[model samples]
Target: MKDIQTHDRQRLAEKLRFLEPDVIEVITTNFCQQHPETKEPGEVDTTHCITDARYHLTFLRTAIEFGTEETFRQYLRWTTKVLQTRNIPHHVLQRFLEEIFHALEPHLTDSEKLVVRTHFLDVPESGLTERQTPARSESPLALHQEVFLQALLAGDRHAARTIALEALSSTHSLSDVYVEVFQESLYKIGSLWESNRISVAQEHVATAITQYVMANLYTCVTPSQPSKGKGIITGVEGELHQIGSHMVADMLEMQGWDIRFLGVNIPHQAILQLIKEFQPTLVGISATMVLKVPIVRDLIKDIRNHFPSAATPRILVGGSAFRALPDVYRDIGADAFAYDLRTLTTLLS
Candidate 1:
């Protein structure tokens, strides 16, 4: 990577001053035209688009001029604050960075392009390190792993349910079994697939078995008599992994929130509609893949724009994606993050 100190910010500033107006206009026009259907009367319309464009232009100029890791870090902090408070989508950051590249590409040389791409854009989804299964000290569940694995691989939902129900009957609360047993089982199965110890079909079968067992356990959850608040939970668009988010929804339900759990792969517009209809106090979004973090950001941003400031729900995000990138959920503009179900319960409580 090129060192930031060696570059002349003045030169980039001069270029940016010249280009900023046109860049903003181009971006605003294109963004508005592309997402006209998102516009609501007296809400996120032309003025909001213009404001977003201006913000994007200012950030890009600052980044190119400063060109430092610290600058990007600070920007992320400020941007995340806006995301949490103002309803800016995470993808808007990505989109703005991309637009800057398009605007500057014609006038800038290759070296300058590299700096912009490296410093402000091109963040690896799961961050810098190679991904690994989180290290754990011991199994939290009481069930025999060998038997659970056999039942899952054999596609015996009844056996899986029995094991889970047995745990519930003995020492495990629903939450404990979920995190200790089901989550652990999924993790082990995932590891097996990673190491070629299990077939994709077997891994899928395990997931299905767990899902069935989860449903069996659901009827037993007893929330406090009065509801705490309302919540709507979902996965981002194109994300099919519903288990983690569903676990959260169930936990929240047990905690006395009126839960409207919309599972995996919900469209953006549909989420907004639900937010309008459900009128939740909290919105829990989950994404399993790094790429979908942008979608979470966008979802939050859209929620901010679509709802009145007071009415917009507090956003909570979790899942493997956040676990892999420790600081990313904040960057995505979530009000808070739940690293695990225990943490989630505490945050909600």
Candidate 2:
């Protein structure tokens, strides 16, 4: 095997720059105080923090390698420790537990893992007569892989790049592992939230981690074009929840969109100027939260007013918040609302 390098360590260091200087310092101090032998303890703090994000869960092989029945059980029992801390909320702890356990259960012994799945994970053993069984192929996930996730959760940008390079060298790209495995892991986080097995704060921890994790992924992949792929995609003013937009951006670029991604919080006049500047073949807007409807409506109006030549470059609206209020689209006035990335691709060029 090729030697593991400092790329992961560096990611942790860079991410520390974004954190509360004191929080990073404290984590470093604590990690050093705890494990001094590791010369690169700076990044280790991020790796340590992400275990709670449940990166271990989706990549079952990784979880099986780093996770223990003991750790898994403790995550399940996070409320006790959190309660003792007296600072964190109960839901926060619950979300941490749910994500890790859901992803790991498929690899764990049926009897032990099933207990939580039956009670949580949103999948019932009694329901699916045909379920996937664990395999050796599913085990042996690298420590660096789990560490990369931790780094991203902790906002350790350097660690993100480092582990990403490490993964890339091993006959696979991070995207090779990311698209399906990690996506499923995130789905588990959402499933836990929708089911009430985990608390909202816990869900936010996972969501925050998941969102930033994608941000980290952007750093690893070299940009073929500065504006995403080669074109442009954006959301309306006040519509943020770039998660859905990011996914669509990735998928669209893969399908040759030459992407220009204008992430959430864009305003009306700004978008009009952007439309004129970029002259994109298509315009995609994502609305994951509710308040974006008005912003989107205004965006459509401005697009027509300024770029009347383009008329409509396939306006698209997506995300859970928009999906929840399909009725609002009549008021907002978009050409289409996509359920997922593939559908969005079909709707546009």
Stretch of 10 with least lDDT, candidate 2: 59-68
Q: In angstroms, how far off is 51's CA in candidate 1? A: 38
Cα RMSD to the true fold for all candidates? 13.5, 18.3
Candidate 1 has its poorest 10 consecutive residues by lDDT at 124-133
Clash pairs for candidate 1: 87-301, 88-301, 89-297, 89-301, 90-297, 90-298
lDDT of 2 by residue, 124-197 (tens): 22322223446535423345556654564455556555665566566665445454434545555665554456
Clash number for each model: 6, 16
Error of 1 at 223 (Å): 3.6
- Candidate 1: where is the Cα deviation over 4 Å? 1-135, 140-146
| Top candidate (TM-score) | 1
